[model samples]
Target: MCDDLQVSYPKDFKWSSWHVSCTCFLMMTLKTQSELITEINNGQNFSSEASENFIANTPGNFNAWLSENRESLEKRKSKPYFLEENKKFVK
Candidate 1:
């Protein structure tokens, strides 16, 4: 899954039981709407134009925005991006 997502780690990095537990916890957890929006805006998953359009269209209504883009967001979240992004914390 990490390879499929193109999330690479250091060649010397090793996955321990703690790392696996943390990864599983991250995958199973539900992120808040704000966290999702922030991630979408900050991430490379969506183009700048798309992010701008989402913000413009939503106008502070994250719930509505989430409802409209739930599937895409879920797909994005399912990727190993979080593992890569939060690798420091995991380590």
Candidate 2:
């Protein structure tokens, strides 16, 4: 929502390119954190096979990683430095 794209949420509120969103104003291509990680690893952000395995399944693998890291991630989200919308909900 903070980004340039205007988003609208419906009752179900589960539309997503990678994560959740309901509607989008402009044509937007959103990438999951896993995808970004995969790209970075492939492009030499860090050279390792670990990143390869980590993002091998695209959204599913990254989503699992998110589940695994939820507690620490919640703590990070609690910080004021995070976005206001994210402050309301962890997702």
Candidate 3:
């Protein structure tokens, strides 16, 4: 993931904010994908059991989960870049 991130966003770009945001976004996406893949593998033999719990837990389950939890979706709510973390956006 780090390798991909580094390759995707060159270090010398003038848009430092864009580079940082893109790096964070890519990392988060990679994490989510890895987690989903792990879940799929672990549930392959007991898909029904896992599906039952997942369905019972969330009202709309998968769709609602993805909709609410997607970083990519939330990213579009504002500008493509973010100010430094640990502080509010200056705007």
Candidate 4:
């Protein structure tokens, strides 16, 4: 996870107290993609031995997991770029 906070604002952007506070809060709370993925994996609990074994042996489990959790995932700032680039490959 990156500890550095890299916020980009327009040249005419003004620094207000509310803006500053929100920015600070977001910087402190946001997690990187890998970090979020690890967190989700750590929190997962299998209900049955068969299900656990299936996930463990699955070749595309990571992608499957990401797809399943896509709606709940908080995408990073660069998500737009990725979505654009991969749009052609997505069904």
- TM-scores of all models? 0.20, 0.23, 0.17, 0.20
Worst lDDT run of 10 residues, candidate 1, spans 51-60
Best by lDDT: 2
lDDT of 2 by residue, 37-63 (tens): 777788855433333333222244334
Expressed as tens digits, the lDDT of each residue in 14-38 for candidate 3 is 2333343344433211224455577
Query: What are the runs in model 1 whose C-alpha is more than 4 Å off?
Result: 1-60, 77-91
Specify the poorest-scoring 10-residue window by lDDT in model 2. 4-13
lDDT of 2: 0.40
Candidate 1 displacement at residue 85 in angstroms: 13
- Write out the backbone clash pairs for model 2: none
Q: After superposition, how far is residue 63 of candidate 3 from its true place, in Å?
A: 26
Comparing candidate 2 with candidate 3, which one achieves the higher TM-score? 2
Candidate 1 global CA lDDT score:
0.39
Q: Choose 1 or 2, whichever is better by TM-score.
A: 2
TM-score of 3: 0.17
At residue 19, give the lDDT of candidate 2: 26
Q: Which lDDT tens digits does candidate 4 get at residues 8-54?
A: 32222222322222434222223345555665789953333323122
Q: Rank the candidates by TM-score, best first.
A: 2, 4, 1, 3
Those runs of model 2 whose alpha carbons end farther than 4 Å from true positions after fitting are 1-58, 77-91
Each candidate structure's count of clashing pairs:
0, 0, 0, 0
